[model samples]
Target: MVPVRDELFARLERFYDAIPRDGAHTEAFGGLVLFVRDGAGWPFYARPRLDATEPASAADVADVRRRQRELGLPEAFEWVHENNPELLAVARSAGLSVLEAPLMVLDPTALPSVTELSDVPVRLLDPAAPTFGADLAARRAVAAVGFAAPGTAVGGAGPAARDTALVELPLDALAEEQCRTESGHRISALAELPGQGAVASGMAMRVDDAAEIAGIATLPSARRRGLGAAITAALARRLLADGVDLVFLSAGSTEIARVYLRVGFRRVGTACIAEPA
Candidate 1:
């Protein structure tokens, strides 16, 4: 069933506005909100102020882009299509290409538990473990390759793929993106195959009752074997088990969304991501 549009969007609005408080600060430019990185953690992007009566204008988009240039940040913007459809047009008018991701929320009652793959159990990434450094580097590499390869289609890439990436995937790889400190706000999980290590990886970010499962990816060779969705399920199940009221994610494509659907996530909205042309 579709959720009440206003209620759902409002909940998401609060989730968006509150999430950056942990590692970034929000700056207002007319009807837009830019989450500026403060030297650490995740680098957030600009989003629409859905609660505002008037939609974001082209000038508002230009102003945010100017500030991003001044600060040396990626001139990126994101928002839910239903929140203010015009904002996507605004972003386009400002000449940024937009990606429409399938926004989904888990059906808690229908959520499934995926504990392992081919006997390799899924485990949360331990920052204090002996392999933490290698695992972090490997996870980053896998995600990089997985995203580069795109979609959930299985290929020949696996641990061999990640190991090759680990050759140069520095231990300080966390600096490139968000943190994985396993605190209240952020948590990461990984699954390992025999010989191959950390074949799949994902992270969950919490903001009060809401949690977003993101960066879920599988090694290219490991695709079609259910590893990506397994990692995604493990992360979502963990958050819901920990008392989060809503667990959601943005699927890169319908193929990926179908993988998530089998994990009990139902499409609720379209997450519009605006990036440089």
Candidate 2:
């Protein structure tokens, strides 16, 4: 098996590189937002930005700090466009605290069966179905309301719209083994990405067995019931059974991260955001 850290990093790199290249950027938000912006969202391998305040060889830590504050970029984030030790060191000096690292695991042998929850109901929705329209909106609305309490200005409404557009592509990429399950009408979870005939996270838009969690949500009224964990475990078991070899995902919150951990995931690395100095 590949080293856990290496696998996780490679998975993340694939995701960062896979963002649509036409007109936008996928900013993986956190203490350090990963800015994967390009026409093609190609993964950042190792290239230095000419906009840096100093040469990569003599990078001034203070320059990174100034640029971060000036641009309002996350205090801590990696400019994955290039790979340089000094770049990371400079960002660290600027108050960008480390958070949970990304993680990945290979399960070529398949995941164990997940016991069904007797109490909660699970629903599966077709990503291509027109009825799927309001589902994304509703989920984002609930997410917006949830994030508001934490003092963040996240507009789930927008992602909901973008999600509607991406669904067709990501769904098409999902393997037949990819399946979705939700807990009752209150919380829904889908393997969104397909991997190895099963749903895995991080594989979307281009290949199979590279599944992404596509979407997961709980009704505002149903928060705190642990429905999230139930849905995740159920999904994991189903995907594993389908022959998924590895799985990867990004967490929006520590709470979500903990739940995923309970389902057999471990942390690998974290990303950060930076801007031109």
Candidate 3:
């Protein structure tokens, strides 16, 4: 039987598989898949967020802990999102704490007007900048207080530091985009499936339902001008044309949620995060 929220996640899983994975770090723990960019020490960590079949118990925690040790992931980086209350209990038992998170969506058709983007321009970046270094540091000062924040909080922190750490790790091939003002300052940026000249996506080890929308951010000076909404819509449109039906992304606030809702995406559910202290 199809579990509740499975279709949404199934779409994500399929998208994940569709993309190439030759440039990022990956670790499999149980049935959970954790992906990280090599250049950014540890800014983003993605796994299949879903409800658990069995209640998280001591044994489950122990098993996860063992998996972590074997995979070399920091205990602090471990997290879980599930509708099963028992799963939350299991995470607590394993020293993880839950944070309130909301999943937001938007329909591509309803996306607001972006013609106001006269001052700001978005362009694809070449030799894609490392995700966890200078590019990320550039936004911390401007990012929203608790929301629209990437790095560290949701793992998109320290562009330089994380990028260095990811230098040697095996990472999936990546594509990058930057939100820049007319003055030539990049305010926000994003990384998606690399669109390098003719590379086989299957060789990229792309997961079947996982097209990770990584490092989405906008600069302080570029806010309120519809840059974010425009870029997001552009990405969504591209993906849909490429034959992707559903896209998955996590939001840090209602404001960001509003932008997404204006676009054509609908919420399937919440993606809760539990981090180890």
Q: Write the per-residue lDDT of candidate 1 for residues 67-102, one digit (tens) a residue.
A: 999988899898888777888777888899999999
Decoy 3 TM-score against native: 0.55
| lDDT scores in order | 0.79, 0.40, 0.42
Candidate 1 — which pairs collide? 157-221
Specify the highest-TM-score model's number: 1
Q: lDDT tens digits, residues 1-277, model 3?
A: 1124655555544454334243366554443445545553344443432333444455545555566556575543323243334555656777777564455444445544434322344433323455433333333322332123332223333333322322222232122312222112222333222331110000011133233333345432234545455555555544444454445566555556665665555665666666675
Clashes per model (N, Cα, C within 3 A)? 1, 26, 53
lDDT of 2 by residue, 32-141 (tens): 22333343222332223323344343234444345546655433344332233455555445544433334334343333233332235433444555655444434444
lDDT order, best first, reads: 1, 3, 2
Q: All predictions: root-mean-square deviation over Cα?
A: 2.9, 10.4, 9.9
In angstroms, the error of model 2 at 247 is: 1.3
